[model samples]
Target: MKLLCLSNGHGEDVIAVQIIKALYQQTDQIEVVALPIVGEGIAYQKSRIPIIAPVKKMPSGGFVYMEARELWRDLQGGLVGLTLAQLKAVQRWGKQGGMILAVGDIVPLLFAWLSQTNYVFVGTAKSEYYLQDEVGWLPQTSFLQRKLGSVYLPWERCLMKNRRCLGVFPRDSLTTHQLQQFGVRAHDFGNPMMDGLFPEVPIVEEREEARSLRILLLPGSRSPEAERNWELILEAVESIIAREKKRRLCFLSAIAPSLDLNPFCERLQAQGWQQNTTNSLSTPVQDKQGLEFQKGVTRLLLTQTAYHSCLLSADLAVAMAGTATEQFVGLGKPVITFPGEGPQYTPAFAEAQTRLLGASVILVKKPSQAATVLHELFSDPDRLQLIADNGKRRMGEAGASSQIAEYLVNQI
Candidate 1:
């Protein structure tokens, strides 16, 4: 079969890769073609397939301007430039005799609908319920989401009604149910994309050899909130270092290419802090799947690389509320999530964060509360261990990737 995977952001790219890999694993005879949103196209290269990017030449700028123009062109031309990229790429692979399958992004869904091609929609693009529901860092007005709601909803509903449509859900079995509400045939598949990166157990490091406690502080992947969260968490870490002399601290660095953290690192350096030199350490039982950290000051650690390494090494994590918390729970590690004063971390999200992780995630209302909680958790090892044990039970096993793949394959 010929598969056309479409992704918009870095998160979707990770999902697309897992879906493609799973499809190939089931049937090696398939040919895959990836068409990603302009700047977010690198992850699919590893699928060993012919990949094309539609937005490759488009200048990265205002979403309202770009999306409006693209949507208008699509209405007139049957497909936009990026959609044409998918069409052309799929056409090239079809010549070799295979079917086209889509993974994520709404633009490609528009093209696939126009082309009458069979496709699967993965991640969050076509799911209207998610937009109405899922909480993120962006405000509704800030991203033109409120303005584009009318255009996007109708387009999404029409696409969802198609018999060839398939959708993936991250949290619930709502994908198929929600699509069915719009007169579409859909099915729930476990989220296979979550299986992207798993850390391996590391050889016992010297610090760990002495059985010293290691803690991780994850502010986030973006600099705007990360800087503030890092400062808050650093104060808590300082308190821990002072009280518990045996423990070591590691900051899971977020290095978004669009943002720099050099100034922040320099600031931390002035406070007598240094980057972690020790590698990630998972237990003997998890040795086969743990990730190892490489020593370097120059290379910006990819979000997944840094996160997976830190989760494995540290006994516990203090993080800002977001996807990282979800990842920690999946890894059977309890994390303390604090949503700062921002639209992203509203009161509703604070509640949802706690509910989603059960007891594995603890939410802090203020920076001062954070310091108090960390101090308590550090002082009481039994309480910390109990949280970790509870996390392991609540999250279950780590096979979401394969399950998600199987669901996508069955959709076609």
Candidate 2:
């Protein structure tokens, strides 16, 4: 049997890769091919999956719906032509008479449906929680929206109910129940988003005695925006240090593989942070692998290695990201975020994330406000604990990848 995996966006690609890995483990008889609708599908390529569709990095970062400007920019970048080509590929591939696994929102699901293929829909994007009465204040659809259908529109419900759809997996149980009420065969096995996270024990010898608070900084993977976020976060950290001179704070910045560290180093220098040149490459701190910098009593370690361990070691996180933020929260860590003038991390995005995570993530208006909140949250350990617990509850547990793969194999 042959399986064609359709995924859209960065997060979707990651989820698709995990499922692909599990699928490979299940049987060698099945051949797998992937079609990533947005971005470069770098994760899929890294995992050595056979990519068969046209892929591009749009100006909107695959979120054209978020802003009109992003949509226009993507349109100018041949979005229409690209999408049409990808649709054609799906149609040609579908004729092979196998299975299709759609790993994103309406686009991939629609493509699979149009191709007349037996498919499984893993709805990774929308959730009923966004439109629930309890979270109605957070930007959402109308209150009169169908409780038994998708949060956005009726089209998804129609697709999910289609006869060709072999299985429908939702990100959470609430969504699964909602879809089931709408007469769609939906189930929430678990969230594949939480899969592949292995916690690492921090090295005791590398711990600094003067470091009172350890904070993780995630500036996202996209360029320019990542740099901008880093600047804002560094400014906020500076403010925190200026206010509290007695306690020393350590900052760990997780650099994505796609980003260049030179710009980040320049930004740090522009902000009056000095690189610590004393530690040689052979030292323990250097062996841990990171570029170290200092500003007053605050120390910043920028690293590209052991990213998850950095998150595990942190007391809190100041993240301006999408999937990374959720992953950080899933590890039971509280996060602080400041909205950026973005095609991605806008105020609306922040509000939606806050609602999704249930107060595990706090959104601040500006850098100064972020500093204030950070100080307050650090002082209140009980509040921090509450947020951590909330995060673990909201993000769900790991091991969903293997379960999802098993379901795909059995259903197909």
Best by TM-score, which number? Answer: 2
Global lDDT of each model? 0.53, 0.81
- Per-residue lDDT value at 182 in model 1: 54
Worst 10 residues of 2 by lDDT: 279-288
* Whole-structure CA lDDT of model 1: 0.53
Candidate 2 residue-wise lDDT, 281-308, digit = tens: 3112232557888877677888877576
**By lDDT, who's the top model here?**
2
Candidate 1 segments whose C-alpha is farther than 4 A from its true place: 46-50, 56-115, 124-158, 166-170, 173-188, 200-210, 223-229, 242-261, 274-306, 340-358, 375-397, 403-412
Q: In candidate 2, which residue pairs get closer than 3 Å at backbone N, Cα or C atoms, i.e. clash?
A: none
Candidate 2 error regions (>4 Å): 133-141, 146-152, 199-211, 278-289
TM-score of each: 0.64, 0.91
